[model samples]
Target chain A: MTAETLLTWARGSAFDWAIGIFVFGMVLRLIEVLSLGKKPDLAEGRGSGVKGGLKTIVTRSIPRASVFAREPVRITNGYVFHVGFLLVLLFYGPHIEFIENLTGLSWPALPGGIIAGLGMITMASLVLALIFRLRNPVLRHISTVNDYLAWAVTLLPVLTGYLAYSHAVLPYTAMLALHILSIELLLVVAPFTKLTHMFSFALSRWYQGYQAGYRGIES
Target chain B: MSGPSVEKGINFIREQIDAPVASFFSSCVHCGMCAEACLFYTQTGDPRYTPIYKVEPMRRLWENEFTLWGRIKSTLGIAKKVTEEDFAQWEELVYDGCSLCGRCSLVCPVGNDISGMIRKIREGFSAAGYAPEGLIGATTRAITIGSPMGVRLPALKAQIGHVEKETGIEIPLDRAGAEYMVLLSSMEIMNFPEYLQAIARIMRQAGRTWTISSKAFEATNSGIQIGASDLARELVQRVVDAAEELGVQTVISPECGHAYTAIRWEGPNLIGRPFKFKVRHILEVLDEFREQGLIKTRGKEQARLTFHDPCQLVRKGGVVEQPRHLLDLVAENFVEMTDHGAMNWCCGGGGGVSANERADELRLKAFRQKKSQLDEIGVETLVTACANCRITLEEGLEEYEMDIPVVGLTETLAEHLVEEDQEGQG
Candidate 1:
């Protein structure tokens, strides 16, 4: 099909298929995880697990003082990509428009140039992360196909969006279509891959904080 | 592909897949940040020491059995199944390479409890009989002889007699209706009789009624170390039975890390009920005595010293501040390590690594992390609340030819305790 036709098909049918898979898959994954059920801690708690869980849900975004000193590059790069990716994804005009269309939610968008700058920064950060993963012996040893695949799919949308905006890699319609398709691929595979950490990270962090807090520790 | 023990191991791992374990495995993004937190990795620079990778057998079992994609992959025979060989490979990683220090759990960006998962993974290894020979022997002795180190009641009685003669104080045993029941570790009973003397002198000065239960005198739980809940429960039950029989209001855990955790933190849960008497670490009890103005001290040591926070006491048992407060009473020139308190590095022999003779070289190698911390401060002495940490630090210091002497925090405070005549003169 022509790029125009591809853009239309991507925007119409492919978007629905991707969103359906994303929603259903994430729900199933959550059920698979949460349904396992945590046993009640019979031990007396010295601190509040709920309070600790809430505190960690936000606090864990920042690295611990001791850990940050040892792995500054890894920690800083992690913040750069995550913060830049979320800012670009949530506040960029077109993406916000897409979300508004789907969920009837609206917010002020960041200026186009700022979002574009963030997109580039995020893409660079992701590339550096991949290089770090490939270079670090521990990362290289522990990483599986899942790790690299998660990195690639995460990087694709940012790269494609930049290319589409710049009209550099392909015709405008084709590049924009590819950008949308890249996101669709990410959503489709997210719940099945290590990318599932997007949701499970909060749960895992809360559990860790709760257990630690129950023991009266600030984790 | 499988043996009965391997089958049992897989089944145990399957049973261990609770929500936290499932969430931890699911949320791991393979960043390997936990390696930086683990001393085994940081000291040895071995990629295999990465904390998450240490639980590969459990992770594989979780993947193949739990998730939808994993189930599909398993049906297609594409997923890697947990094998007998995997257990053999991971036994060392789970038992020796890790101290269950909880630093990795604290440092995981995703908040995965990597150390907790390692603890759970040990259940499978032990079930499969892939545990270290030393740990197996300890477990057997703990179950049959009432002590992991095979220290029996007669030996404890002998040590009590020595302490009584040395301290000129009566040592009470099996005294019902005492306000406190104290437990001793075999390490303390055998290697450090001074800890008992400190307890006796401190108890005499505090004017508190305490007794050592002859029935459950051993505090160290090898069952907990070997990851056998049934055996740990039996051991804890003995303590509970003794404490209740004595009608003590509190049971003081000796200056041992794992014992405090096993009895205080994991005990109630292991025995399926709340403890009748509260469990306090010896440091905590001494701190309480200090707070009550019951135990008065006179002078401080002139030597520069630092406190070594035991992993189980600080991180697991929440006795972090007590040791510092108790140390403040006796240490005039106390210095803090770079990562002191809850975030402190382990002594490299916690979580039963000291008991496993096979891990001696690795344990010593991991001690480099502690050695560097000490070198940075250049302390003349190291005071710790855990008896096991005291011996481990002594060994590590001797191995490095470092001149720093290691002492228990309790004994240090006891040395400086105000005598009755000195108190009257003051």
Candidate 2:
């Protein structure tokens, strides 16, 4: 197909299919998890699980003191890429306009130059994360093919978006189509891979905090 | 196939895959942050000892049985299956390498309860008959002899006889309607008689009525360590039956960390109901006594000292502040360890590691984490609330030829208790 046809397909029918699968898969994934309900703690709780759960939902974003000390590079890299990814996704002018069309909400967008810089940083961080994963003995040992695939799907959007914006290598229409397609790939694979952590991290953090809090210890 | 086999193990894993565990497995990003928090990984520098990786069997089972991708993989015959070999290989990792210290759980950025999952994974290991012989032996003794160390009631009575003669106080036996019923670990009954003496002295001074059931005195649950909840439940029921039979207001778990967790935290769930009587750690009881002015202390230790917070007591039992409060009343120069309280490094002998002879070398190696913590803050004495921690610290210290003495926090408080001239019988 021509670049124009690819761009139209990427932004229209392909995007529609990707969003549908993403939403349905996420809901099904959530059901699979929630349906396996945990037993109520019969032991007398020393503190409130709900309070701890809510607190941990916020607190777990920050690395623990010992872990940060031991693995500062990985933790710092994680923060940079995660924040950069979210900022670029939410604050880019075109992304906001796209979101506004769907959600009927508009927000202030970061400047083009700043978003470009963040996109570059995020892409670099993603590459560094892969290198770190490959080099670190523990990470290398624990990571599976799913981890690598998740990393690729996450990295592609940033890379393609940056390339499309700078009009580098590929034609503008093809590059933009690639950017949208990369995101669609991410959405399709997310619910079935470790990328599911994007949604389940909240549940995981809450449970950990609640368990700790029940014992009157902070996580 | 019906007995402890691979199929049974897989079924147990399926049973254990509740929402929290499911969430935990799903959220793991393989960042390996858990390794930094685990003493086994940090001390041994073994990538295999990474906390999340140790639960590989459970994670695999969850993925294959619970996920859509897993279903597709299974259909394609590409899914990894939990095998007898997997169980055999992982037996050491789950039982020997891990102390169930919960450090990894706390440090996980995604909040995966790595230690909790390890605990669950042990169920599969134990069910598949892949549990170490040492743990199997302990569980058998705990079920058959009412103590993992094979300490019978007669042995406890012998220790009670010694304590009674030494303190000139009657040790209440099977007394009904007592305010508190105290349970003892075999470690305390066999190795640390002074812990019993301290309890007697403290209880007498506090003027609280207490009893040690000839029926169920042992508190430590080998089933918990072995990761068999059914076996754990049987052990817990002994304490429950005795406490309820005596109608004690509270059952005091002795200075053993896992015993406190088994009885105070996991006991109710294991037995399928809330305990009729309250369960309090000995440290919590002593702290309560201190707060109520039921006991008084006139002196503090002269030696520079530090408190080793037992992992189960602080991390799982929530008895953190109570020990610190009790320690404050006895130690003049109490220096906190670098990562004290809930974040304290385990003594590396908990979660049945001390019982499993196969893990001795690795356990000792893991002790370096605790050793370095102590080495960083030089102390003349180490005080801990758990009897198991006391023995483990002593062994680790002896292995290192570090002459610093380890003492029980309860005994330390007992030593400083103001002499009450009118000592009444229990």
Candidate 3:
């Protein structure tokens, strides 16, 4: 089949599947939150009341930003991995074009060279993180079979996407098909795993702020 | 560092502690989120002071000897041997940096119990004679003389006598058939004689028959603070035996934090049977007295005061509201500090930190947090129910040069106690 014809069919199916996965993922997340065990009571008294909480969230959270700024190599590697993953999901030219065609919204695309470079970097970083998780005793003890599975499932798309871009052993359409399938699997599983921490972290932080406030302390 | 016997003892106890508290010590993921919850880390901005760091020695042990990566690291010479330096470093990290405040456990998603792990590590150090000289000295005194402050039987009797002389009310001592037995720490007898006086006065005014046991008068359980369960049990058993001997209906723990937990909570368990007598903290008794109208305060409205909730008595014992209820009745201008009740910052002397000479820096650092909390409220006097908290906060205020007077809650109440003649007029 011609590249244009194959692309047209992939776009239509992928759009429907992505939307279905997104809606299902959100419902599962809501269920998980509702099913959580009873949260401890954390009410306290604070001097600034509401104003102090906001100031603390903004000011205190900044200097502590270095926590998220991993080591230099880790940061560089993480940037590449995250940027690549984001591009494939939201910024690849064809993906953007397909989304615009389907949903009537469009976004600027990254240059093809940058996109390809990011894909390689993402693959490298994922390998490094995986190695560390497996080799570090402390990390290994906390991890489960599901944790390894989740990492593999999340990384498959990036690896396959890069293969499709590089047009290695697998044909472009074949690699793209696997990439799309893995991305769909990840979306469905995201809310159920430790990955849900992304959303829960903000909620936990807010609860902490409220607790500090109740104690009559600046958050 | 050169003592082989000490080294062997340390190793043996470390092995035992590792076996006992393995679950808590091995569970940390090192996310460093707990750093923000620690007053030591918050004040010092030292990563070494973080609660996670306090548990790192145990974590390293678990990783090196108990896990695959540790084995590999050992083979590669990347993991260092546990040495005297490691124990010394861990001593400072655990004793100085941790107050066992349980805040980190609250924030931890995994429920790692960093505080519990640190306490167990302190137990290992204590067994090895590696504990700071001050804490070891206090524990030795407590074990030998039956009180951390080393006040003997005569001194305790003298203090009780002085209370009687001042109040013109006979303070009960060694009574054969008292219904309630009150236990006071030596700190109260030596420093805050008025607390003993107040308790005596309150017991007399309430008309409830109570006696102070000359044998187990000291309620300050240094064993609990130093992480020595056997020593703690020995201290608690004295009270248990006293209650049995006197045939008391209830045992009332004086205004000491660890004493309340030790006697009220662990006393029964350590005795290997449920305590037949009831266990009540002094604050709870005061609240009961107020509710029953057994004791009335006349000039309570004149004092401008704020309360400092000792972590053990308030947080661990769940006796927050009773003290506050009593404080509110006593102080007309009572203001709550920024941190009070369960969330209150440590007085900086808890968990044997006050007695640890090496913990001075971290103790002062922890106190700074409380100092700031007090400054925000602008209260001139801080009333705390715990004798340890009273001493710690007083020391803390002096260390910070804050000029805030720390008084016992009962002492504050006693200041406003209505005399028999005055009560009829009111």
TM-score of the second chain in each model?
0.98, 0.98, 0.89
In the range A26-127, model 3's lDDT, one tens digit per residue, is 555444333333223222122433453354344432322223332345335545565667776687787798679878999898877777787777777789
Q: What is the TM-score of each predicted model, taking all chains together?
A: 0.98, 0.98, 0.68
lDDT of 2 by residue, B24-81 (tens): 9888999999999999999999999999999998998899989888888999999988
RMSD of each: 1.7, 1.4, 10.6
Every candidate's lDDT: 0.89, 0.90, 0.68
Ordered by DockQ, highest first, the candidates read 2, 1, 3
- lDDT (tens digit, per residue) of candidate 3 on B307-327: 888877765566788888887
Q: For model 1, how does the per-residue alpha-carbon lDDT over A1-219 read when each residue is reduced to its tens digit? A: 999999999999999999999999988888888899987777767898988887888888877788889889888999899999999999999989999988999999999999999999999899899999999999999989998889989999999999998888889999999999999999998999999899999999899888877778767
lDDT of 3 at B333: 91
Alpha-carbon deviation at B8 in model 2, angstroms: 1.4
Which candidate wins on DockQ? 2
lDDT of 1 by residue, B1-426 (tens): 799999998888888899888888889999888999899999999999999999998898888888999999999989898888898888999999998888898788889988888888888888889999999999999999998889999998899888877777888999999999999999989999999888888888888999999999999998888888888999999999999999999999999888988998889989888887888888888888999999989899999999999998888877888888887888889999999987899989988899999999999999999999999999998888888888889999999999988888888988998877533221
**Sliding window of 10 residues with minimal summed lDDT for model 2 chain B:** B417-426
Error of 3 at A98 (Å): 24
User: In candidate 2, residue B284 scores what lDDT?
Assistant: 84
